[model samples]
Target: MKLHISFKISAVVLVLFAITVGMLVDVPRLDILNESIRNLFYHVTSWFAMVFLFIASFVYSIRYLNSGNEQHDLLAKIFVQVGMVFGAAGLVTGMLWAKYTWGAYWVPDPKLNGAAIALLAYLAYMILRNSLTDSLTRAKISAVYNIFAFVMMVIFVFILPRMTDSLHPGNGGNPAFSGYDLDNTMRFVFYPATIGWILLGLWISELRFRVDSLSQKMNDDLDIKSDRLDSIPRLDEE
Candidate 1:
């Protein structure tokens, strides 16, 4: 009945429909990439979702630091968790694609290394949040750490990869893709995949935030009700 729940269900249905249609329709691929580039739907979509959430986390962290709001910190933390899930999914899909195309499961490629480091940095953020006992302390410390981690994510995921050689496309000396990797037909499917998955990620993260916020509110309300009942005076019978 809740809007968040309804949105979640809608997201699932939309994703399924998109996947079905994407598979059914034929997209013209470039000569070099061939059909192997079809994996872009999943790989690029997941990374786009991850980056969007990570940017959200970074903004919220700055907001929390400027305004001293715990909700911002909590929201940022939740978004980071969601981002990590998306990043992991991207990594797995990338590995699978690489296995088929590059004939290797793992490579010390700059982009891959950077992506792994970025994921670990965010994972460390989660661990750091859980380590503190006091809520305020946890929030303050985590906010600082998140700010640093976000900076590192930008550096590792973008800058470092550009400076070094990578097996992955869109990097230096790699025979991967240039601006021509994604043709017009693939762009049609790819754009929707990106937007749909990012929207789906937000839908899930928003539901998670609502569940947590509602649960906390419910607990606080119950506590207040219990205290009020305890404070009530009873009249003695004559």
Candidate 2:
């Protein structure tokens, strides 16, 4: 769970640089986006991070099922948790952008609804895990459910949105921002922002994994001690 110092420094620097560019650099104003174009950095980048985190979660879930490694299950769980957080951030930022550009905060747009449904699918994974009592059973069943959740997310967030007309850029016949920004200045900011956010998500998940692993270890030690004490005969019994 310990991250290298280099990665820590790199994440901090990339995010700060991206923020500086996003805030200070001037972008070509489109008809609808106008000043709200700045949100592209935050909103789109958050979705990118979510995808990266969830991809990791999916891989770990499969690994857990195949290898039966507790570490893999723990990683899958933590990654999904952090991925949802970024998904929520994407939703909030997208809503703000919609308020300014689309004339409403929440629309019946396919992309918007798809994103919401994707998050709900992940929420179901959390609920399913909590409902199971046995540790091994919870890990195995949740790992299977995690695969389904990831697929549902892909369909809702990526596939369905594009299959239908969407107000979102680069989806469902909508011209992407790249077409509007003739100078392509946003590319410089957008790419770095996406990478920064992905790294930031990993950093957060790593910390959570560390805390959970330690807690599990402590709980296991206590259980062992209690079992040993119970096995010892009391004075009254003797």
- Candidate 2, residues 81-178: lDDT per residue as tens digits? 99999999999999998889888999898888888888888899999989998989999999999998888878877888888778888998888777
lDDT, candidate 1, equals 0.79
Worst 10 residues of 1 by lDDT: 229-238
CA lDDT of each prediction against the hidden true structure: 0.79, 0.87
Tens digits of per-residue lDDT, candidate 1, 78-159, equal 8898999999999998998888878887888889988998998888898998899787888889999999999988988889
Displacement of residue 58 (Cα, Å) in model 1 is: 0.7
Clashing pairs for predicted structure model 1, backbone only:
none
The reply for model 2, stretches above 4 Å from the true place, is 227-238
